[model samples]
Target chain A: MSDKEEREISRIKEVESTNLARDDIRELVIETKKAVEKDNDLLANKIHRSFLDNNIKSFDIVGAIGAGKTALLEKIAEKLTAKFRMLVICGDITTRVDADRIEKYNAETIQINTGRECALNAYHIHQIIKNKDLQNYDVIFIENVGNLICPSEFVLGTDKRIIVVSITEGEWVVEKHPMLFKMSDIAVINKIDLKERLGTNVEKMIADAKNINPEIEVITTSAKTGENIDKLLELMGF
Target chain B: MKEELTKIEEIIANPNEIKISNIQELMEALFAKLKNRVDNYIGDYPTFIEPVYLEENVKIGDDVLLGPNVYIGANSEIPNYVEISNTIIFDNVKIGENFKLENCIVAKNSSFNFKNLNMKNSVLIGAANLKTELQNIGF
Candidate 1:
């Protein structure tokens, strides 16, 4: 077997051991959504293999309108721009504001104007970039449209999935949106700089997240303060 | 957090979620069913006839008749004048008033309004509300 295939096999085994041997139906749903990106598993798997074949790392950053998805990506780009050639795809309802902001950080930025659609679709992603030569980029970050629900159901065939939830959104968010948390590989509880003033229960949100998906890794950071952004980068293996 | 689900991605990844015709009977025949869990809203419990299972944080409303192989999950609210038998409900279910269910399976995070009517042996679910959940983002 090729190196990637062996790595993929081991990864699947690791996931099965941790996730499948329990009554965690939510975890099951997470795994289910991986292949079945809205009943287009065939296409989703093809997209998955293409990324793997090219040896490129892709992540879909999901969050709300003001949850700091773009800010966090900008922070990462600043620190790792020289180390890893990166591509940032910003999805928005109409504006290219986010894409413009990220481009200033020296990482290549592509703006996807979703128009009236609330989220990004996997087929659209594949079709839009099929002709582009992705060889120069080692990592690609696709910042999803700024809504929590519309993006949860679609698996964009990325290597990893990250969800950003801010303290400003409140404590109940982690528990309220089990679907998002369950499907995510990492949860970034952003905007910690405002914690003291907001006085929201960050611990409760972390606890709720751990309770929902034991396999999910949680990171607390404030992109504005530059606090723990290095930790996030280290966690992301940059 | 920011997000969205595509049309194809809206299709259920789990085969069990497929709404087969006669799912109620299929549930009985195969002994396969859903167990609803709750953590958000709750209700009052007025009565339990026999062999009822209630999970942690379950709330039931007044004048509700339950039990005899009925299971109401955690954080689930069964409103007033509701009767259930031989059914399994999953978590965070928001139920309506004046309803009746028998030998049925209700999925998690399901909320609907049904009054003075009976539902039996069916698999019912409402898609996860990512739209409303945007509230948690303070959007």
Candidate 2:
């Protein structure tokens, strides 16, 4: 073989050899949790203080996978972008899907790809806000990794915590993830467009959230059609 | 069979799922959701995996790797040296050369007109007249 061909062959081999058999994602979740102690939790407070000082409104959105977090954010950005200086710090385990989606509707996006952790904690925000000119944007939306349980435990230095659940997730979604509801300032029951055919109990879902956190405001929306989005923004103090 | 396919799709949601999702099927569903009854084929055959929907006015360039469940909407452009799989590209969008995209939904009127970009598992949308940068992974 020619020298160039030999070099290419060795390069391919080198790339293949680096593909290690890592632990499963589930195991990685548990391993990541071991580090989320009091000290780690306090890191978010630091970021929160900075946001407060800068007068930046931070909204942390947490939800189940496919619960329409990105869709909802898109709607919000579409409606409020002309009136607000908005940006989204979108988190995912591997890809920049949420960030990319939100960016479509006139909002700037910062894609945070969490390597193995199931959630975005204050530490992640602490690291992210370090470089941002915090004054450029008045409102920041922190779209947490699409997860119900793990994301609830992490305070992402946001002013308000919003948990989104879709009727597509089934009737028991709110009841099942009570802690997420408890931690949230508002609960969004999304995808009402599919509710009629799916026959999901929307009222029951609202009751579930109300029972868990009486202070939590509940809004039913179809992010697809922009239904009740204005009401959501109004409640969010847009 | 659909239920089995759906179970595979659930794997795509959970990062910790043991099995891989059937991406090709899901891409098909996404395209069918927004498909219009119009011809979109406007290019010579690159490599296309079975069952893709190219919406009206869609254009493909040479040496492209297209896969199943892929949908290119009307008035969109997929240039040469591009590899796409399990993706949904909406209307009025543009693509560039040496691009590799998978498991992504490119929203309407977006521009990915950049060279040598690699994006996977993304939902891309942006304003018109906006240019995209290429992010090359690995050394």
Of the candidates shown, which would achieve the greatest lDDT relative to the real structure?
Answer: 2
Over the stretch B1-139, how does candidate 2's per-residue lDDT look in tens digits? 2343344335433534322445545554554553222222434545443235676777788766564346677798899888776676777988778878876766667776557767766656554232333222110
Q: True contacts preserved, each candidate?
A: 0.00, 0.00
Give me the TM-scores for chain A across all models, comma-separated: 0.82, 0.84
Residue-by-residue lDDT tens digits, candidate 1, B1-139: 0011121112222435445333344333322222211112233324442235567787777766663346666788788878776666777886777777766666667776545646765555664333232111000
* CAPRI grade, predicted model 1: incorrect
Least lDDT summed over 10 consecutive residues: which range in candidate 2 chain A? A17-26
Q: List the residue pairs that clash in candidate 2.
A: A104-B125, B28-B69
| Local distance difference test, each candidate | 0.70, 0.73
Residue A99 of model 1 has an lDDT of 73
TM-score, cand. 1 vs. native: 0.54
Interface DockQ of each model: 0.01, 0.02
